[model samples]
Target: MEFFKTDKIFDFMGKRLPFLGLSSILVIASIIILFTKGLNFGIDFAGGTIVQVKYEQVAPISQIRETLKSTKYANSSITKFGSDEEVVIRITGSSSDLTNDISDEMHKILDSTGKFEIRRVDMVGPKVGGELREKGLMALGLSLIVMLAYVSYRFEWRFAVASILGLAHDVTIALGAIALFNVEVNLDILAAILTLLGYSINDTIIVFDRIRENIQTSKEDELKELINQSVSKTLSRTTLTSLTTLFVVLTLYFFGGEIINGFSFTLLVGIIVGTYSSIFIAATLLVQLKFSIGDFRAKEAEKLKSKREKEKLRAMYEQGTV
Candidate 1:
């Protein structure tokens, strides 16, 4: 299905100034919000108790929430799991007495309802949550470093730098959106963010690879034109991939319920941002860095010459022509 051939639109390459300006404002505002208000870390990041309860009959989540609200527990979150019959309750309470009493009270309340059963109860300490947070940060940093090294090794340092910046742009934008919406940052969300980073980079790498190919093959054009051609050639793939993924994510967002909502939301934003970065931000960064095909061709020719020389040397040694 050809979705409105974009050939006509491509004639007038749209100005990126507006996008850059708006994205910059969003990123800056998100950073300010992050520093000022900070993320509302969920039980996984901050210490909390999680209770997974199964009910014989479908019970009202609002009733459960109301029951928990009447208690002295702070920052309680009650959500339905796969169905109304299943519920996951999270509470953040540091006081030993409060934690102990709250659990007991919850059991008593549910027991009175006679429709729910306590299937599992788990408690996470603040220390553990802190460690997880640290580990998560470390993982994100390591992934970025690895991506930078890989891109640099495969292509050029300029590409690596630009790709990483694009990744940062996507991440910052996602985080900013989350902050703007005051969404709770939980382990699921962190995982989503990390997944977004990887997925976004994958999209970027595809574009970068195309650019590299175009640079090698399309020798008549300057860097900007080469990049534009690469982007234009890859536009269909990028759009189709993003749209297909968006369909799945939209499905999850609408039907996956509260459990997967954070993950889905993160993915939705990531896909859009990833597509945008691949087209504009990533290629634009390369252009801004003044990357030239001359340098790339020189490097490539050097590599090709070295390979050919090695091949000739081997052939000469075999045929005694050296």
Candidate 2:
């Protein structure tokens, strides 16, 4: 479904200065925030114990917290899982017996209230958490390097560079939001960020595809006008796709419970930023890179010339072998 008339055109290039300026401010602010505040690493990246317990009836989170105050898990966090009968407790401790101690203590006190079961327990040592953190960073780096190679091979250098920068912008803003709000960074959230990278590049590729088409099909040499036309053509499609994805993520954020909250929240931030970068940042970068129909034509002509030369060499080489 089209959100706007197909005939309507927007002047994205005309507002490039403002759009770019705003992005610069945001990126700078995000950098500052990241340096000052830092991420709130979860148990997956920070040593801790996580216990999942299921109660026969409603699990009173408040009472559980109050009761645990006198125990070693005084500062523990308690949250309802998928239902009121299920709860997850997260404790920041490096003790090997933490999981068993917590389970035994809960059983000793709350057993009188309702029959419950220990569903699962997770314990990560500080050293293990450090290794995971390093691996996570490596994973992100490898993904970006791979994307850079793919985009460079698929499109022109201009398109490749613009798309990569756009992805960086989207990620930086998303991370900044996480740091600003002190959102928990866990393995699940790392998955969300990786997913966000894929989602973001898909949009950039779509716009880049249109931009390529617009450049070749048009006779005009006005780069800004061509870019504006291309962005306008694809704006409706981009908005529609982002909105549809947002609907699912929003549902997860609101009702998916605490287990996947960080994951869903990361997606929530990434979606909005990704859409903006695809349309404004990535597209505008094309204009800044001074892409033109003449440049595209020259590149195509060069490719054809190179192909003919290769064919001539192959023909000579084959004949010589005989």
Candidate 3:
């Protein structure tokens, strides 16, 4: 069934101003949030302790949190583990020794409250957290470099640069949103952001691939017209892919529980932003990079001239228009 006809509503020329303005506002707001409020880094990034305990029966997280609050480990987070019978506690104390003591005290508290088993106890040092932060940034940088190389080699340098720019745009916007909302940035959130990078790029590559194909086949069309056609042709596929993925993401976001909430929210935002970037940011980037309209126009003019010459010769030979 046809959902909607391909109207030129998103024509780059017509809607460029609005799109650019909105994107600029989003990006700037995100930057301000990042610098001012900053992200609430989780125990995985900040030095803290994680304790996993298994209960003989299911226990309420609120009860666990209250129990820890009553003890010396006042600032603690208690959440369910994989199953109802298991609970995970995270505590961020002032000192490493205090953190460890807090973990031990938590175990004793849970044991006293009910019959439970301590499954795992782990502590992350501030130094270690710093190292993890460095590594995460390095991984992000490497991914961008690799994407730049792959896209540049596959298409053109301009396309490669544009694709990377689009990816950056999505990542920054996602990070900014997270910061603005004061969401915890843990290993999982980092993982989600990285996943978003790859996902957003996939959409971009698809659009770029179509653009490249249009460039090759439609030699007579102007660059702007070719871009419009290319994006329009791929509109259905893009919409279907995004909508199908969003259906699953929305389900997870609504019902995935606290553990996966951040991950799902990140994915949801990424998908929406990714789709938008693929069309406006990435394609508009080509024009911004000075893609040389002259090159495309010259090629089209040559083709037109060749066609006219052939037609004129045919007319002379056939005694037609002269």
Candidate 4:
């Protein structure tokens, strides 16, 4: 099914300046927010104990908080896990002794409320958390480098640079949103960010590939006009894919439970930013990089010319026209 009609024409390049300006403002603001506020790291990145408890009956979150108030977990955070009958308790600064007996202690403290069961327990030490954090940063950096290399090999260096920058823009804005909203950044969320990087680059490659094809096939339009036509031509595919993915992510965000909340939320933001960058940010960068039609079309022209010459020689051989 088509999200947009085949004949639809949009002047994406016509509004390049406005879109680029808006993207710049957002990226700059995101940078500032990230620097000032910082992300709320979860147990996976910050040393902590996460105890999940499920009760037979609906339990008020406040009662759980009150129950923990008298115990060593008084500073812990209590929130409904997936339903009112379950709750997740996160204690950020659990001592070794406390972490050791956390499951028992949580059972003892929460069992008094009602019939409850310890669903799961996760304990991350400072050293382990530090190592994971370092590795996570390295993974993100390495992914960017790999993406740059791949895009450079697939397309021109200018397109590769633009695509990578667009991916950076999406990631930065996603992180900024996390920081601004004080959402907990966990291993799951970090995974989502990496996934976002892949998806964003994939979308960008689609547009760039289309532009390359257009440059090779048609020589009637100027650079900006060719780009505009290419974007317009591919608008349907881009819109349909992004919207379809958005629908799935929104469902996950709403019903995937609190454990995966950070993951889904990151994807939610990243997809929107990715879609925008694919159309405006990455494509616009091509125009700014002074992309020339001749540079790309010259080789295409030579190949086409050779193909025509071969076809003519075959025709002459068959018809005795040589």
Which candidate tops TM-score? 4
Q: Estimate each model's TM-score.
A: 0.85, 0.86, 0.77, 0.87
Winner on lDDT between 1 and 2 is 2
Q: Pick the candidate with the highest lDDT.
A: 2
Q: Write the per-residue lDDT of candidate 1 for residues 1-322, one digit (tens) a residue.
A: 5454545234212555666676678678878888887787776778777787888888677777766665664357877777768988877854353545555667886665557777777676788889989998999999999999999999999999999998888998888778777677888898899889888888889988988997888755677667667777778888888899999999999998767887898888888988888887887888778888898899999999999999999999999987
Instruction: Please estimate how well model 3 matches the true structure, expressed as its whole-model Cα lDDT.
Output: 0.80
Is candidate 2 or 4 superior in TM-score? Answer: 4
On the 0 to 100 scale, the lDDT of residue 267 in model 4 is 96
**Model 3 lDDT per residue over 221-302, tens place:** 5667777777777777778888999999999988887678888888889999999988777887887787765574466568
Off by over 4 Å in 1: 1-14, 52-89, 94-105, 109-116, 320-322
Model-by-model lDDT, in order? 0.80, 0.87, 0.80, 0.87
User: What is the C-alpha lDDT profile of model 4 across 163-206, one tens digit per residue?
Assistant: 88898899989999999988888899889999999999988888
User: Which lDDT value does model 2 have at 11?
Assistant: 84
What shift in Å separates residue 41 of candidate 1 from its native position after superposition?
A: 1.4
The TM-score of candidate 4 is: 0.87
